[model samples]
Target: MKPTFIKKGIGFAIASVIAGGSYAETTESPVSKNQQPNVVLIFVDDIGYADMGFQNLRDDIVTPNMDKVAKDGVVFSAGYVTGSVCGPSRAGLVTGRYQQRFGYHDNIGPRVRDKNVEQGLDLSVKTFGNYFQDAGYTTGYIGKSHDGDDKKFWPHNRGFDEFYGFNNGAADYFISGRNVENSEESAHSSIHRNDEVIENFDGYLTDIFGDESVDFIDRHKDSPFFLYVPFNASHGPMQAKHSDLQKFAHISDPLRRKSVAMTYNMDVNVGKIVNKLEQHELMENTMIIFMSDNGGKPDNNGSINSPLRSTKGTTWEGGIRVPFAISYRGHVPANQVIDDPVVSLDILPTTLAIAGIEEKEEWELEGVNLMPRMTGKVDKLESRYLYWLTAARSAIRDENWKLVVPNIHVQNPRYELYKISEDISESNDLSSQYPEQVERLKTEFERWNEYNEDSRWGWNKDRYPYTNGWRGRE
Candidate 1:
């Protein structure tokens, strides 16, 4: 399908006024009477609560482009990632089910060379892209694909028609030849057209991804498409071009300065893609989702999750809570903020629902569609139990109460039950004052645990035992 531009004639004045600008041209793609809207999932890596301009961050970091997305769509003030880390959190997101359900509660097993092993998304579970592809949507994945232990788990095998990104855990933004390996032709920072490795090209990873993403949208503008762009920015091994870092030179903390500048680059790239969609007249029919894999790695990334206790790899609100927004012109509400508890796992089912894919027969999907809640069709999200276990730690959050069993990797028991509503930073523990509430939450956690096969499947080791962190540090 191709879009045609109309030329000015007798009604040229009215047309030009509506167009507003010279490029305000109208184009139409042939639709099959019923076509699903395009879907763009922009998943950012390791970002904190105060990382963006929309989240009321007091920091000097500039993210006006990301803020624009929140302003144009609905931003969820209290959004959580299922896990406190990347691998498991991504597992929860792509599958629309709790990571524990498929024994993906931890990061990919040991990273060893010549292990002759590939780690990635569970080969068995159906991904969001699989459903979209089944329904005839052109699915493309253009960044960070970290699942777990098998080659078949890559995006190409997981149902994406086109895949272009790294398959390993993390790669240096520069010097791609050393880090990346693709099945197709190779490109620098290791470029892979499909499954093959191509030659590396010289450019910023963020910019490369953004440019490729815009081109993908342009190519698939006529057809329904699903674009998954997961940027590995604001994460570890902080690297930013000298020009980007100049903006944050005043910050004494070198890591934080570079991280903040990297964030600005991320924001700029986001603007680039969004503007591309708008220019193509595809914004109205496209659903754009922006969220992070998990919270920030403050120590390494210079991220500050203020009002949030602890940092990434912890169960604290700061660890799991992230900035999330959804924008679909005219369909989703504008400049709205949602406080209802939601998680990244909900994206699959929600996006699938919007794409009109029926997975009602599948019992594995644990997430409910959030589009209704965002659209004001529901007063409040249904009360449901949410559980998170990682690195031997366990946390159960139900309603306004949350129970945290810290330091699960060590011996000696220490527990804190905080009323999150009253203490979002998890400051005060009401466990002693409300023993009954604690017991209730505990029982609920156990019951949820019972339904899963092996939440602690790889927890047999003594170093990171399940009950080690249940007790507090000395």
Candidate 2:
């Protein structure tokens, strides 16, 4: 059964009584000659394009603090996640490649028993943490951690020097309970600080992450740091402090009201960290990038994916498209918005570029350095065929045209093509009118898939189509 209004209201109240809010950060500006600028990646779960103030979301929702970052940095109007869901999307972000390329498309198995014995990032793959650590940066990860379910695959094992957050996708604000159920059978949904479970946290989860981030900076002020702040806010089993909910009580939709409150809390925490950066005079040297793991789960809350069709768990614009912004005072320009298409896979390369790391010609990385585009060194980003595929569907988008083949398991699936520019919501299908364009895209997708291997999902020719299964989607 769906959550009722009264149930949600009571949940909010319980969350409030247990979760308080108090935050503080470092004040000294410590810069080292050999140290690179501090990197802060604020990754919010299940937020949508219309959730932020700059996005002109429903006027009822408030996100002024996040708007401050957009006002001070370049906001990418057309930013996208690697996948529409959290696990694979995060895997792609961490590895700088499509997760399907490595067979990590599914969530990690439960903590108790391995339903499928799924593995976290293969030790073979390199993570952003590995790169940053190799470059001498002190890596710290705080808040929701979903990349791995097993303690062996924790953030500390994935290249982060200091890890303080839950191991699953979502945890309770104060109680630190695993709010969302994982597909894995034995996984326990609980909170942890380092390797130990947290019996009690003094404040809300969002506030805890922000305060920990500040402390991480204070301890590593003399050195370069990479801080990954992944908040469990706005993702369900909806919970937020009462003060935040009271601010949005006028909203009639109980789900949406809770969403607004959670988002407001996230924004306030963002403001807290940004203020810390300024106080330490490290704002100029800090490179902060804010993005969501995927599109919002509309059913879960008021996470809006307006002007775009569908929601989380589908291969639609609303499912993959998300709000993305980058801020580095004196480095990235203020108030610039890049509407061109970009993906989460590009973050690793971009961050490396910012930290003065250059890739060898033979490195074989998929993402390009976005610094040129962000710094006005280039006119625009290079265009390439962006592809999406899932067990049930497959799609390819180039420029304004997109081709979707739903129910791919069938022998003769109907292909529907649409001009996305003319129909941003994907309300129309024009496949019959443009057979040539459809064939061209289909052929391109086939060609790309031919050279790749289905590393994420073991090849199951009986269950999946495609000659070898190296396609972007399984």
Candidate 3:
């Protein structure tokens, strides 16, 4: 269920967290004279591309802090997550590798307990905490850790020095509890600190995550730290604070109002985190990454992935593409926009660079250091084929063209092609019109697909609410 290889740095021993224990750093390099910058990776769940004020898609969407992330730094207009759903997407983001490389092609579900198949990420796979912890930085995870069901795959043992989030995303945002089921759903809905369950909390979960993140920054202000705050806001369960709800009373739709409220509350928390950084004078030295784990599920979360066709759990622009921005004051160029396609996997490598650590060949990382592209050192990002796979569905993006392979079982089953540069909504399928392009992309996808394996724990049909056509019911 795990690999045997160790990622070794050229002249240093890379940090590796033993099964459920800590491994002392073999060679602790002296803290750099320049003081390595801190990293705060804020990951939102099920967010829509057009939901942010920066996207200017909706008049009602209110995300001022998120908009500031774009205004202060760079926004990857063609940003994407590795998976269309949470579990698989996180597997790729955390490990900095495509989830399919290790048979983690779907969201971890009820079948996680199956003895015949292991549903968690392979233990040997290095994560965000591992790299930073090895580099002498304090690491903390403040929100959902949906990597795996097994405790070994949880944040405590995944190299994070401090873990304060729940094991799943279904947990109530408020400790007061929502309509979470009394059975299986409840099991993954409880909040925990480290490995212990915390039965009490003062405020909303998003606020709690923010409070912890701010405190973490304060506690580690003297040293470089990597704080990953994967907020479970605006996801599911449809609950929000009364204060935020009242602000969105102008919106008549009750459900959407709740979502907007939740999102607004989340925006305030982000503002809190940013304020703390500024207070510590760390704003100019820290790298802040804000993005969604995957596209929104409009029906599920009242999210609006406007102008982009399809929703979560499908191979469409709306499912995989997301709102992504990075703010590293005095480092990355200011107020810039990069239209080239980039993925969540790149965050790990970019943060590593911010902390003065370079990727090693043995690490087998799929992401590249984005500094050159963002700093205008390079004319464009090096070309690469970005791919996505889940069960029978797989898609590959090569340059501006995208080819989506339908599950042969779908009615009128055929290959779908779109010049994403022009067809942002994925409304035009030109597979027939561009047969040669389709075949070329198909061949490239096949070659890349050879390295991937089947999902270790089978699939999660819950996420596949969409049908096999252009739209859900089409």
C-alpha lDDT of all candidate models, in order: 0.74, 0.73, 0.78
Please give the lDDT score for candidate 3.
Answer: 0.78
Using TM-score as the measure, which candidate wins? 3
TM of each candidate vs. truth: 0.86, 0.85, 0.87
| Candidate rank order under lDDT | 3, 1, 2
In order, how many clashes per candidate? 32, 6, 0
Residues 1-474 of candidate 2: C-alpha lDDT, one tens digit per residue: 211111010000012111222223445665654567888998999997678766754676567666766767788776887677787788888878877666664454322112243446777777888889988899998887775545677888888898887776666665633322221332435555666665544677788788888788778877788999988888987998998888888999998899989988987888777767766778778888899988888887678988777888677888888888888888888878776678887888888887887765554567777889988999788778777665456678876788877666688988888776456667778888889999999999888666554434323544322332111223
Q: List the residue pairs that clash in candidate 2.
A: 103-455, 103-456, 111-187, 112-186, 178-189, 389-473
- Candidate 2 lDDT (Cα, whole model)? 0.73
The model with the greater lDDT, 2 or 3, is 3
lDDT of 3 at 420: 77
Q: Order the candidate numbers by TM-score, best to worst.
A: 3, 1, 2
Candidate 2 matches the true fold with a TM-score of: 0.85
> What TM-score quantifies how close candidate 1 is to the native fold?
0.86
Off by over 4 Å in 2: 1-27, 30-34, 109-117, 176-187, 361-363, 451-474
CA-RMSD of model 3: 11.3
Model 2 lDDT-worst window of ten: 5-14
